[model samples]
Target: MSTNAAFRLQDAGFSRAQVEALGEFLDSQAATKTDLIEAKTELKAEIAEVKTELKAGIAAVRTELKAEIAEAKADIIKWMFGTIVAQTALIIAAVKLLH
Candidate 1:
């Protein structure tokens, strides 16, 4: 590929030295297989880290929701108990008045 590009550059009236220099510069700029592999490894590591953080956050939110639901259940129970007691008292009072 470099040879083809260099030949093309030479055909375009570039000097031999300029073609060689440009070829070298292009080679320097190109990413190697090793470079790509290293980048892929780093990307995988970063993705794994993000997944761990998200899992931890989800677990925390689940725990908080469970606690909130328990508190609401307790509140409902208290309200139900109070209503039952008041209803019983009124019934007793009405029965006494009738008697």
Candidate 2:
């Protein structure tokens, strides 16, 4: 049937000042932990969003590069065909003039 000061405080016989101070301290500790958790979650979400954007950007660049390469290949084929036809005509004219 005996109790201590800590027990009396638990039973609500303590002074208002002491109880309020203890409550404020507990609340501050809980708030700090909650703030840390929220900050970590927000940072992780931001990082994931940035990674997704970067991947999309890289894919777009790759697609553009592939299109450009295909266009260059077509241009080269046209140039090669034109050069061969012109050279063949020059050779035929020179042979006729010499004969």
Candidate 3:
């Protein structure tokens, strides 16, 4: 507390001793600049750790999705080829019967 504040408190009916004790108590309970900085640093570290874990998880999921998509594409190609061959055989048999 500044001298001005102490003087104001005295004018407002607070004793010198009372004002001094109040200032001391308030200061003790308040957080310092260093305390806030330390808390901020710790929070940043925790956030970075979480971010790294998320990135690794996303990469693993991406790999799995790619594998699944490739397998699906292979199955589709096989089915398409089989359908085309079967269609061609039916068309040829129909033309011979019609003649």
TM-score of 1: 0.85
Q: What tens digits encode model 1's per-residue C-alpha lDDT throughout 1-99?
A: 367888898999999999888888888999999999999999999999999999999999999999999999999999999999999999999999999
* Predicted candidate 2 versus true structure: per-residue lDDT over 1-99, tens digit per residue: 123544678677767577667767766667577799999999999999999999999999999999999999999999999999999999999999999
Judging by TM-score, tell me the better candidate of 1 and 2. Answer: 1
* Cα-based TM-score, every candidate: 0.85, 0.63, 0.80
What is the alpha-carbon RMSD of candidate 3 to the true structure? Answer: 1.9
Pairs with backbone N, CA or C atoms under 3 Å apart (clashes), candidate 3: none
lDDT of 3 at 11: 99
In candidate 2 the C-alpha lDDT for residue 34 amounts to 73
Top TM-score hit: 1
lDDT of 1 at 61: 100
Local distance difference test, candidate 1:
0.94
67-99: candidate 3 lDDT, tens digit per residue: 999999999999999999999999999999999
In model 1, which runs have C-alpha deviations exceeding 4 angstroms?
A: 97-99
lDDT of 3 at 43: 100
Please list the Cα RMSD from the true structure of every candidate, rounded to 1 decimal place. Answer: 1.7, 8.3, 1.9
Q: Which stretches of candidate 2 lie over 4 Å from their true place?
A: 1-31
